[model samples]
Target: MSEENKTYTQEQVDKLVQSETDKIRTEYTKQIKELQEKLPPEKDEKEVDLANRLKALEEREKMMDVQDELSKKGFDRELADFIKSGSDIEKLTEILKNNQNYIPDKHKGTETTITKEQFKAMGYSERAKIYNENPELYKKLSQ
Candidate 1:
């Protein structure tokens, strides 16, 4: 019983340590399982990613729509972000109507292309003159 006189086999000490470690591991495992069971099921990674992507696409589409509307009204495209965030279309439209960014497109109502019937009515020399003057216009009209 004296100090330095007692000796325990290495195998016995190892078994004792392993038993204590196993007990701790088992308790922690049980607790972890219980906590996990109480929690709601996790969403699939793919589903979460898809949902995020879809939201982004919708936002982008909304922004594009706002830009198109603003452009159609002669407002600067830079104002698209402000209009896109506004929930009320009427309010946004009114704002755009009053904005300094508004610059009426000079070519808006002026038809740049003519129908085949109109082309047929024009004389050959007139058509030849138009073709020679601006071939791109003739090509667009033909389209």
Candidate 2:
């Protein structure tokens, strides 16, 4: 005896494909749910997003506060960002305290000039010599 092979109609083939697709989808969904259950409870998406935003805002606020405090203490604008990033307020304060109103030793005695009253008391030759040496100073004092 010989057996004959049977061919499936297009509609039957489509139904069979649809059933397999549905079965695979159901299995995948079940596996995904099981994996999710194995993990710890998660925060809501909105809550997680808001928390991250809040943290960033707090950091920005802290940076601004540091900048303000440094500026008020007369630190140079060029070094503000470096000091703010480093976040060492005490070091900044120490630098400001040590360097405030600093004048180098070389600049100490270079401002000598005779006033009009002092020049008037000097001898005629001395006045002429002083005027010749620094005419600009003499002119300023004479006024």
The most accurate candidate by TM-score is: 2
Clashing pairs in 2: none
Candidate 1: C-alpha lDDT: 0.80
Which residue runs does candidate 1 get wrong by more than 4 Å?
1-10, 34-49, 64-79, 86-89, 92-143
TM-score of each: 0.38, 0.44
Residue 143, candidate 2: alpha-carbon lDDT: 75
> Can you write out model 2's per-residue Cα lDDT over 1-143, one digit (the tens) per residue?
33366677999999999999999999999999999999999899999999999999998787777777767767654565676554486786778789989999977875766767887788989868867987887777667
Candidate of highest lDDT? 1
Clashes of each: 0, 0
lDDT of each: 0.80, 0.79
User: Worst 10-residue stretch by lDDT in candidate 1?
Assistant: 81-90
RMSD of candidate 2 to the truth, in angstroms, is 6.5
